[model samples]
Target: MSVTDEILTPRGPARVDTDVPAGAPVALLVLGHGAGGGVDAPDLLALRDAAVAAGLVVVRVTQPYRVAGRRAPAPAGHLDEAWSVVLGVLRDRHTGLPLVVGGRSSGARVACRTATTVGAAGVVALAFPLHPPGRPERSRAAELGTGLPTLVVNGDRDPFGVPESGPDVRVVTRPGERHDLRGDPSGTAAVVRDWLRDRGWTPA
Candidate 1:
């Protein structure tokens, strides 16, 4: 599979860069960015590159906030609406194939929340933030519902202790890394790819 930069109009303008084996039956994995960055964040780009190399079609989309050149995070209402748009685009483009949506930090939150409502094949939560670093009690994990096979990959020392374990959830811990799975990109993608394959997802 190879990457091709393209733009998809969801809301105003959504910049989507995709990598997939042309005309091959493949699953679509949506990649989102962290709160303070766009789709081009270093960690996000690395994941995109690794997933693409593994033969999966990967789509990295910029949030409307970043597209508008604002540093502040979008309000929940606006964020949800924008995600709806992005989801629609992904669904339309990859019709009949398994769809996996995930993001960095805030991006992961948005995608996870959208999954239950959007009906994706599965959810890929990379560096899912349980809560702010020091405020573990204020976790936002409830949004990630069960029954849907979810892959939660986070650093061993990730502030929220996401590796602690959860019933019906597959979790992978990246040793000595931070919120982003920095050290082992291939290993990280391998776990996700294997899980999707187990669920009968279209091979990359």
Candidate 2:
């Protein structure tokens, strides 16, 4: 089943669309959208469906700025603050469930920044923007060093450079895909599903 709820954050009101599996959920996977997109991005939708099928509760978050109809994203600090609040609320509602946080692009960055603060068991970073297009010097790879198990799926052809694997980070490249991963969202979802299964977060 699916439910939509509003959450008050430090910045403003955020939205969460939750999908629960028919059976008891093995884990809770929270996802956010890219700076230029909403919760309905093809990859997010696919991840939601896949996680739900794998007996995981999936929550797609619409940040406060997006809820207020703004295409531009809030500042990183603001975004992280709001996300922490939302995660706290969700944790209260579903206590004892392992929490995995993730998102695409800018959203992925937010998840990484707040993973430790929010106490996420793991992170799923879809299309993590390693650096701004054509600017490798300004690498944001440090964000992926959350000290938590992180799965980073990126398009091999992304203009935004792909991040390299670290001690706690695993990088998965989708062939012929771009930053959006729209070329094969299901394939992207499959990689996530396998990762979850490997971690014993989902039924094998």
TM-score of each: 0.85, 0.99
In terms of TM-score, the best-performing candidate is: 2
Candidate 1, residues 34-136, lDDT tens digits: the string is: 7877777556666666566555688887777777788888776666668767788678888977778888788887887787677776777888888888887
Per-residue lDDT tens digits of candidate 2, residues 1-204?
A: 569989999899999999999898999999999997998999999999999999999999999999999998889999999999999999999899999999999999999999999999999999999999999999999999899999999999999989999899999999999999999999999999999999999987
Give each model's whole-structure lDDT.
Answer: 0.72, 0.95
Query: Model 1 Cα displacement at 57 (Å)?
Result: 1.9
Angstrom error at residue 49, model 2 = 0.4
Clashes of each: 0, 0
Looking at model 2, residue 82 earns an lDDT score of 94
**Cα lDDT over the full model 1:** 0.72
Question: Pairing residues by index, what is the TM-score of model 1?
Answer: 0.85
CA-only RMSD, every prediction: 2.7, 0.7
